[model samples]
Target: MSGHKRFWKAVSVAQENGLFEPRLDGRPIRLPQGKVLAVRSSALAEAIAGEWGQIAEGASFTPDSLPLTRMAGTMIERIAPDPQTTRDMLLGFGVDDGLCYCADGINPVAEQVFAWLSGYGIHPSVTDGLMPVVQPEGYLEAVGQLLATQGDLDLAVLGVLAQATGSLLLSLAVVGGAVSLVDAVLWANNDEKSQLATWGQDDELVRTMENREKDILDAGMFLTLGRQVSI
Candidate 1:
């Protein structure tokens, strides 16, 4: 019942400037707008090729099934539209990082969050108010430095992960090998998870956490898969 048809007999990857390009039938693939489809990651390129390779002679594929390739396109078409826009977006994630907040308790989850913050060179000081105040002076510069070499797609997914985790630092931790994707998500939701544990779970909170978990996993796994890339 698939309406897709394969008109090409072969799919291959070509290298360019430390990036990878997908080729079909000895010709490089193009975007829907006829622009060249390229990626800065070998693993990602191979993954895209695998998507195309999986299509049977008569089978069709959908965008939903090709998230990796779609993200590559989105990177070129949307995320890195301009240098200023990307910089601003990167700064947005650093403004209100999740690690800057505390749960007002001595629980293990909160303690763990404090530990990661300390590891990242952030030291919290007791304030005059009822809450602890922390400023991530180094977070902005670190994330911006990360953006220096990251292609559009990398920034796009990092933004997604940052928003999902409510902490650019955590997302960077995921990208920088400081923590696993699942651990990052679990930590991001630590406060809520702890609260929900004793108070009971509500549909809204549960659903929100579920979606965040999925986004974190998708973005984090994509980054992990790209780790093998030579660049």
Candidate 2:
């Protein structure tokens, strides 16, 4: 007998209007806004259902336990409804992109970031950590346009990545396959790692970094699964 007392005995996917819906005990799951949760990718729907199915009935759990579900809900309830707001929020990160800020006048990862952005015709200005770097108007416009091209799901995933890493460039790099998720995490935590080297390692800080890495990886998986075509 399974100790996991799940609320739903079975999980299934329903196809409607070319979108997939995950059902709990034959009832469609609804988002926070009361809309039935549906996604363009059947794979994503299944993954979301898997999260729900894994929940133990009468067992404690939080939103953090359901990353895929939370992301899918975000796509439906937030990003899909007002894409411009989300796009602008993501673009805002570029204005003071973490990669552009160099402490001690040196950022080892800046050259790689520059090369990645070059593919999209964006050349951002870099500056020492002392002052904020104002990105060019053209660069902002280009980044906005690039973000606009992303679908709701991609935007949602990018939002997670940007929030986790605090750098739109690193998020975009992950999306564009310009860098591995490992590299992105490493680059994003470069300053912190440098500090850890100077100061003794703090267990709490290390734990926080590990959680952040997991979030980034989860976002990457969500993006990949969401892009898959249902057979």
- lDDT, candidate 1, 17-102, per-residue tens: 66688888878877765667787778878888887887777566676556666666767666756755775776676666555564
lDDT of 1 at 126: 28
* TM-score, prediction 1: 0.67
lDDT for 67 (candidate 1): 62
lDDT of the candidates, in the order given: 0.68, 0.83
Q: Write the per-residue lDDT of candidate 2 for residues 31-90, one digit (tens) a residue.
A: 767999888888888898888888776665667888998888898999988999999989
The residue-level lDDT of candidate 1 at 50 comes to 85
Off by over 4 Å in 2: 1-6, 104-109
**Per-prediction RMSD in angstroms?**
5.0, 3.4
Ten-residue stretch with the least lDDT total in model 2: 1-10
Give the C-alpha lDDT of model 2. 0.83
Best by lDDT: 2
Any residue pairs clashing in model 1, and if so which? none
